[model samples]
Target: MNTQEYMSRFKRFYWITLTALLVAASIRPGFADEALSRRDRQTGFLVVAEDRGFIGNEEIIDEFQLFAKTRNASLIFVTDERTGKYLRNSLDRLLKKGAERIVVIPLFISAAAPRYELVHQLLEREKLDVPVSYTRPYGESYFAVEDLADKFRTIPQPADTNLIVVGYGAVDSDSERKMQADWKRIAEKAAAGFGFASINILIGHDKKKKDDDAVARTEKLTRELADAVNGDGDGGRKTVVIPFHLGPKLDSMMSFDARLQQLLPPGTKFLADGGSEVRADANSATINLATWLQREANQSQPLAREDVGVVILSHGSDFNWNETMREAVQPLMKQYKIEFVFSMADQPTIERALRKLEQRGAKAAVIVRVFAMESSFRKPVERMIGLDIEGVAQDTADVHAGYGHSHGHGAAPSVPAPRIRTSLPIQTVGGLGASPLFAAALLERARTLSKNPARDTVILIAHGSGSDHQNELWTQALEDMAEQMRKSGGKEFHAIRVATWREDWPDKRAPWVDKIRAMVEDAKTEGGKAIVIPARTTGQGPEDKFLSGLEYDLGSGFAPHPMFVQWVDEQVRVGLARFADIRRTGMTTVEAKSHSPYPEKWLWW
Candidate 1:
């Protein structure tokens, strides 16, 4: 169809869709009156996502309508490809429906996209009586990475898995490059936690797929993929393919399995992310997007500070563990209502905390997970809070078609996962592995045992994950913290090293213990005393059991340190600010000034 003809049909369809939405919505007994009343007090919201070709899933459409009604905002959703023709009408519709002011959400991966500019220009040129605000795109947000990670979690074994992500790129070379860069950013962050043996990203281009070059391009891609899975030393590793395109139609268009079947190993499989004719991220049709919308909708309507609460989620074992966590976070009670839950994202425990916060009249909550890395316990916690989802529905179809797996090589979860419901505006901050505070804590612990910087080798140790990929990540997190320490007066130490003892994984424990012993032996050759310090949350974790013959001083981990309190306090402030950020800039943290948890008389250690 011609541009004008296609637009005419689309506009008619758009009008019919909204009209049908209104008619269906009014049928709810008392919802219409209450919703219209709420919208009267809220700013209108316009969210534009990419043209994913399929935007008409009834279940998805109902979710969006309900999201709009709950926010009490005249919310409109459109695609980037249709905005030039559809946005003006949508804006007019919002105004007619009762919006005096509006917020435009261009939900692209990066603000560098040309659509980002067109949005501001269109808003300026088509100025209505109502005021409007423009915000940044998803652009490097943790939420976008979490979106992909949710899909990866279902795979059986991440550490031993080889990942191949197939993407449908922009037709233009320059646009394609930018798009690939953004995709790489999301891919890296999402995969960092998994420690996949290898990651291969393939972006397909129309120019290469043209009739003239199709055969050559097919041959080239075949060889390239063969080398990736076979000759590149990842041959034996289990490989999982992700079709990163908008929908299942693209999967058929690519004909991935038919073309590459000869190259794949027997156990190779595809992740089930395209259950929907259209994937959620293509059009930003996710509950994560809805939660973000809820946050923005509440921007102008500020809740009192007293109405906000903080929930500190941590790992606890026994009485000493839980009590130490409580003592560490006690100072936070002065500034905000606080509830500390020391469980591994336990549903019942988290629900009880939410209920307490609700009883305290909290309209919002900041969830802080206290672990070594951001990816730790992230999926389960997020799914419980209704912020992320798994691509479960498509698995059945993939397996039936013989391109999926029925079981995984990795160990299963110790407990069942159960989701909870809540209406509070919630923002969650991840672990403190990368935090300067954590690095400083490590330095302080080392200092307690270091008699002479030139003669001491400080070894930082932690209880690590059973998954090899996760264990590698734990080691990397400790290394990152060590780097931070080295920059901040840790240069005075003779040497600082990092290690992860895969404590829970009996099969993996002996090798890690041997490595620790070798490091200690290396330290002794230079007449250096090895100072082994626990990098754990609290207590000595199997350090003595493994290092019995070694001569090293073992200092308490972060348990008694004042900086631990500071880290929790910092997260609380950051979480609150992120929840209220209407612009989605990802720059939600400010320096902790007078509110620093450390008292002058207290030692940092």
Candidate 2:
């Protein structure tokens, strides 16, 4: 369809979808109106994210602002999760204004899901009812699920079509069943209509069993599928595989895909070019998500090309999966007439990406995080990438001159300095965590989960970090994003929680072993409702053993969490989006700031 036609259709669908949502929502005994009505007083909020040993998940303040703007609610207290402290001292002012609720909303997605849960827990313990609900996932009305599905349908059909649906499987009670059920339905439905004679579904596994579990399981399954295909060629059968995830190149799934391919017989045919691969640093994954969301929001109308600049920010890594991620995103970057695109970590930090746009003479840039929630990774990114160019420039100049480099270095410079480019207006977009866009993509995932309702509770375990602040950032993002499942879906307040490894043990504590023990206690008390999502950048290496340990640790606290959990899936998606953003910008530049000599009070580590 033409652009105009697409927009018209989208508008109709948007309203219809919203109407369906409200209709569906009406039945849910909406929040107590009287309780809501009691919130009549007005109060301004004093928000602050603690700068911990590493970057904390503070970016959500920006997201919360947008979300709050939509709801027209006032924010009262903003504090850092690390310190559990607020930056601004506006408590008395708010009380004087007759503010009834002192809502302490955490910007981190998973660290605190429905603010209300934490608020409820605190209220019950303290005997109060200010009622603070962790803001749930941004509902799907504005996100792009149906649109993403349409994109999936657009996969080119090959004559020998065989399909495989791959994804980061759930480890907990609720999610694993959901994933299996989702895949079965999608595969069955797709196979029936698409004329595929054979279909295979494999959930990437990374538990603490044997050394070769992933390789063995994938090889065994693929071989089974190949064996099913009748090589007689009487126009009788065909086979195809489609990854259920947004990217196919991710290490965990890719490792399995590679092993499976190697095991396939010579005569077996596979579809390599058409299927989606969810790899870290793949721009296509985020683009696919972005395009899908636009379609759902009725914002897909081809905006003036100059008006849109897509910037993807993610927790980048130095791994083979990072390369796979880059490969997957190249096509989308070339296809779209994006004003400017860039990624963080792979050569161009967000600062450098903005510099490219500034050089291009663009008016504005749309910055999006491929990640799932607001965490340390993204929190520092906001300060690093989202400030006004003017402010960055000032900061750069102050750093340069303060370092006593004010002397003219125009000629042969004695010392080289980092370059900072100024001249771009940036707009920070919310990360994919429960954003409407991802909700659409995940709906497919959820639908599958629902079919397998036998699973207990869903636990998403990410490669949380205690090692460094950077690691905590990524984990926090996943934790935050997991909250969406509770906000918009059918699950209850008690059904879902995003768990991380590092948080299980604070700094100065034991490593994976202790973290596992903590989660074990949490799981037992919570009715064994835990599903795991490995949080490494891509599913690879010993991380899986650590990620899978969470389950084993449940009863015996002897096992450690798997390194490769679903959190990694989310991180890879975030990385890919950022990679695409960096690709569009040829090069990046960041001016080095000058710092005063260490104060006498400062001690060396």
Candidate 3:
């Protein structure tokens, strides 16, 4: 137990401690690198442009790449119309680099451009397994309009000068026509904001077989425009030619502009510049494009139309309900001028929305009712506009015959009727009713929850009215929808039953709830699953509250689905077309009623 023994024991203990420390270090996990890897996952952006050398093309690519880098995503640029080989190579490289997702952004004037379709076709042919998303071309975006307006603000107006906006025309006649029409619209909007003697939109692309003939036509149009400007006054009037385009000016367009300048009469003053073309590559526009791409990527869907106004009307209640409805209709706003309105709630009423649409100069207004069946709101809406439309009335005399009360919570309240009027003709379409579209929607929901429809019973539930006539209508509509589901479902379901929230005359809500519970219980006893489909506008409401604790799979109500939106669009089209027909043919109310889809009893005009 002297110095030698102490030294040996100390050495052994030190070695053991060192070995344990090394083992612990080897097992320890490094999380910093893993966090960085997730934060820097590879994202690919395939920019499809018309021409490689087009003005601002390089700038756009650079801006987009820098933007992507900020988001830790990489970008790959490919000129579409120039060649297919380059695009293919770019896409292949992006895939080989292990990009998690690739987003294709067409740097074109309009989504309607043929080049946009070409990119889509090429992508479809490639059939890459990687997740891909597409964004609307820059021209179709409202951001483009804003960019143009900002650019227009920089120009100095002479008060007597006429503004001429020119667009690169398409080879296809229809495309050229549409392009011209769109350019004219742009010119009108731009002119409205500025004081111009007159504005004209000239198409640079021509359908003529001979280039010389096209040039001559262009010369004549330019001369005519110049003449109009010069004839406005003896002198001091100037013509400002604005080349409305995205990038490197085409040789053909420059030559045409030269010819237009030369065709002007002696002593005529003219100036031709890039005009709003510079805005294409501006920082604001680039930021807008970046923001849009990010949003589309997050949502997994493109935005709605920015030109058309859409009013989504629903029977709103709480803040949560309104917010839910807003989230549901948000995707539609991407492409449309959309506003959410509450029929019975506060703020942004139908009348307010109609005025807003008029102020926005909306080409058309679509009033979409998010209700399932015909409600008391419709009559009030019609009366507000001084329209007398006959609608389904409850037969109170037959109340004892099993129909409920004529009026209840569902009835429209007796508020002072709004006298708001509009010069724009209104088209009041019915609710979901018993349309085939609603049937299809219900069937889809059923299939989503059905494990084995062959051993499942489906129950269609609606917010039934206390009115005897209304309940009858609801029952008939529900039965028709159920029958449709059966036919389309093709024996997948064992049976389908239709029920309402309100019970017959003597009994109230309890009987209907009991009936639904019994149906579910019977289905379960028979070794079948019960699927309850809410036959209302939205998935929310009293259906869940009324049928709580029932062993059943509940399907969502009709709103928020793409099919519902399509139905709304169809209704808008039908209503607008009918109004147009009535105006064109000078048709009487009776004549219109004869052609109406709704029953004559329901027509109040």
Q: Which ten residues in a row have the lowest lDDT in candidate 3?
A: 24-33
Query: How many clashing pairs does model 3 include?
Result: 19
Sorting all predicted structures by lDDT, with the top scorer first, yields 1, 3, 2
Q: What tens-digit string does per-residue lDDT give for candidate 3 at 1-605?
A: 44234334433443443343322211111122233243234545566654323223344555554345423343333333334555566666555555576666556655445555566666666666766655445554334554444445555653666666666636465776767776665555444436667676655553222233544454556565666556566456666666555433323232334444555556554444423322232333343555444432322222124424667777676787677777766655656666678654222377788778757745445566666664435554544433331122332232212233321235553222223434233445657865678888888998899898888898888877676576777778788788877787635788889988774333567878888889988889889889988887776446667767878888887767777767776766665565454333321221233342223222121
Candidate 1: tens digits of C-alpha lDDT, residues 1-605: 44344334434444454444433321111245345664344556676544322232332344445656644343333323334445666676666666777765555554434444456555556757776655435443445666666666666567777877655534455756766776776677567556677788754433221234444544555565666666436546777766553321222222233234433555567564433323233333254566554443443345556767888887777897888877877777777788988877767888899878867857688888887667666656665664543111111111111101211224555222334545465667767777887778878888877888787888988777666666777787788888888899998888899898877666788998999988888888878888888887666788888889887788867755788888877887787676555224321111211352212221100
TM-score of each: 0.49, 0.30, 0.42
Model 2 accuracy (lDDT, Cα): 0.35
Query: Between candidates 2 and 3, which one is better according to TM-score?
Result: 3
lDDT of 2 by residue, 1-605 (tens): 54344334433443443333322211111123233222334322222121111001112223334333312133222211211211122334344545554433221111212221332333233332343212111111112122223323544453345555554323343544545554554445333334444455555432221233434444545555555454334364444444343212222332334434554556554433233432232222133332222121112111334434455544444654555444434444542223222333222455566666545534345555544344323333433332321112222111111111222324542221222222233435444443443432332343344324233344455544444554455445555555655556626324544445543344523465455555544655765534333433233223344544454212111011121123223433443444344322311111110131112111100
lDDT of 3: 0.55
Model 3 TM: 0.42
**How far is 281's C-alpha from truth in model 3 (Å)?**
57
Q: Which candidate is the best by TM-score?
A: 1
Candidate 1, 422: how far from true, in Å? Answer: 8.3
